[model samples]
Target: MKVDNSAIHHSPVAVSGGTLLAALAVAIFSFTFPATHWALGGFGPWTTVTVRAALAAAIAGPCLLAARAPLPDRRQWPAIAVVASGVVLGYPLLTTLALQTTSTSHAAVVVGALPLATAAIASVVTHTRHPRLFWIAACSGTVVVIVFALSQSHGAPTGGDLLLFASLLICAAGYVAGGRLARTMPGWQVIGWALVAALPLTGPAAALALGVEPSRPGGLSVLGLVYLAAVSQFGGLMVWYRGMAAIGVARASQLQLAQPLLTLVWSALLLGERLGAATPLTAVAVLVCVAVTQRV
Candidate 1:
């Protein structure tokens, strides 16, 4: 179907607006890990991942039709598939499985390194060359996170910790892919089409899962699943991809530095988890080191 590209055409969004929307996206995303932790008690991890994507695609589908948004160009399909692989399936599935064993508080601390991961991946995906110092900074951030993980002294890297680390790698790739696509396409379309592309797989998976759900789930678990589908998987991402495009991936991503702290706060308040006194210090150190990766 043809589109009046103008229907979804976004002019150059102001940096201030982009930053605010990015912050909003981050605020919404801060709920993801804790909510997933809660939802897992009710749903299988794979069920949660696939169903969330399918439900989100169901919402994005009608909106695309209503907007008359054209499908992304042929060449863009590959990138979109890669994005779907990571954001739609990889990150959600891995993190959900990880949280099945890891505390929300621990997940928050481990994910504190996401900004650095994004920065490093953005550089490669966008084909920008960073100075040697940037690598040094990236390594510094990695070291800080590793040391913090060790200090937490789980006595060997738990399976959950490894899953979270893998999730970071997949998510970083998705972020860079989304950011690159956003430069030419509207941000919303990037996520919209990714959801669409994932539908054939996730849609059926979700349908099958519905047949297997336990008769009754907690009220909060039901709410958590809805939030994951509506906000985390779909709506907030429309804002996030746009902001990443508008502000440039490098600068716009700096906002994620606050995500860990906010997530820690949410985990405590929502899940009644206790934060280590060292949590703030670890988050700050990771952020500072990650901040260095953006430097040329």
Candidate 2:
């Protein structure tokens, strides 16, 4: 039997490319919290969430039509709805609400557990078992996040913390579902269709929100809202799902461990949110866990 050197050589290249794409997505998402904070400076939370989804749908719908993208299979609609609800509606709304009470840095640290949640959910959804070491590292990371959250709230979980936790779980489900769907369809199409599917709900909701919410919409806030719509909602997920499809979802999710740290930096630079001593410490600890899981 001949061992194929070509396959051996190709595998690492593929993984590297996938890892790069996932890392890029993480970088894009890191700005989201600060952006949301900026948007909230001018718009109410409801208005911010609904308007971003509506704007993203506007962009994605036209792109799909221009590309002559085929409709998803009837079976896939349910999964697409999950994507829409989780990332498009649930996560953004919940996180924006949470950011109302919490600083962007605090929210970023609390969300550091997102990768662990995503990996756990991906395991169940894909029915793939990782090694014990992987779970240990992931759990360790979650523990760090939980401890930080508790300490920040003086041993009680604030409403913001609870909301962030809920957003984490739902967003993980969305990530896994979108990743699986990406295996069958183009990653861009998966998110594009999900945005279009969400339009029915988000369109009306945006209209109502704008009417009720009284937005000031300053220059920075408008730019922030546009970023949420164009990049965070649409462009980031396109590469993220593609990376998840290329790599396994579990592995790709581990890459997100870097997100909170990146977000911490953005919080300081963009939002001017002061980070305490524990924030960087917790972030580094989580990154250590990320390294362990990736190696395992």
Candidate 3:
């Protein structure tokens, strides 16, 4: 089978489009966590996840075939499985569970921790060397996020707080492993096989979820679910993995810090959520800190 090496290697347009698409994907993904939380006012966490993943698989499957993306080899399967479990399934599930009670703003802050978490985990497992500035930036970003989160504590259990934290940890692991796989496979192929690997779980999870009476999802709610599945999971991931392949995982992770701000925009538009007086100032600080890491 002939692969499109040109698309993979030499196309500047593909690379630029991939990067933009990845950013858009993250933006759309940020919306879904909050939207899913809203939807869960009507659906179970497992149900929301199952439906979302099913939609993503449906969209991604045909695209993978058209692209002639290769299936995972024996050696590649382990890494693929790791990402499937950690990212495709674990991240969404945790986020879904977390959003049930946590505010979207809080969820966004927790999700922002992803870049820092990715840096820490990758340093430990991959023998990758990053400059001191990177560590400083990563730690600074974490502190900024935590300060904002604790300052606004609602003094109640929103399942989202803990779940989002767990999701970030798992997602960081997936990013590190997925980067290694992307070195050998096309970005789309890594996601395609990993999605397949995750099917055994996603399939059963969706089926069990189907047993419930789906709440009357509004037009916006339905649209949000579809966006999460098709855009974020399928399209966004394709571009993100490509970015991961282009720049190493640790470097590519800098993109994630943008997620919180982007998400705040979506929340304001959709849910009438406003940024706190300090939100913007703190966001700038976080961005600067994350930018410092990119210099590393």
Clashes of each: 0, 0, 1
lDDT of 3 at 214: 64
TM-score of each candidate? Answer: 0.92, 0.93, 0.85
Off by over 4 Å in 2: 1-14
| Candidate 3 Cα outliers beyond 4 Å, as residue runs | 1-18, 66-68, 154-159
Residue-level lDDT of model 2, residues 16-80, one tens digit each, is 88778888999999999989998999999999999999999999999999999999989999999
Q: Which candidate leads in lDDT?
A: 2
Clashes, model 3: 1
After superposition, candidate 1 runs with Cα above 4 Å error: 1-13, 213-215
Q: Could you tell which candidate, 1 or 2, scores higher by lDDT?
A: 2
lDDT of 1 by residue, 1-296 (tens): 22112213444557778888889999988899878877786887777888889989999999899999987888899889888998889999989988888888778878888888888877666566777887888898888777777777655778888898999999988988887788788888899999999999998888787777652478877788889999999888899998887777777678888888899889888788878777778888888877777545
Q: What is the C-alpha lDDT of each candidate?
A: 0.83, 0.87, 0.72
Clashes by residue pair, model 2: none
State which candidate has the highest TM-score.
Answer: 2
State residue 243's C-alpha deviation in candidate 3, in Å.
2.1
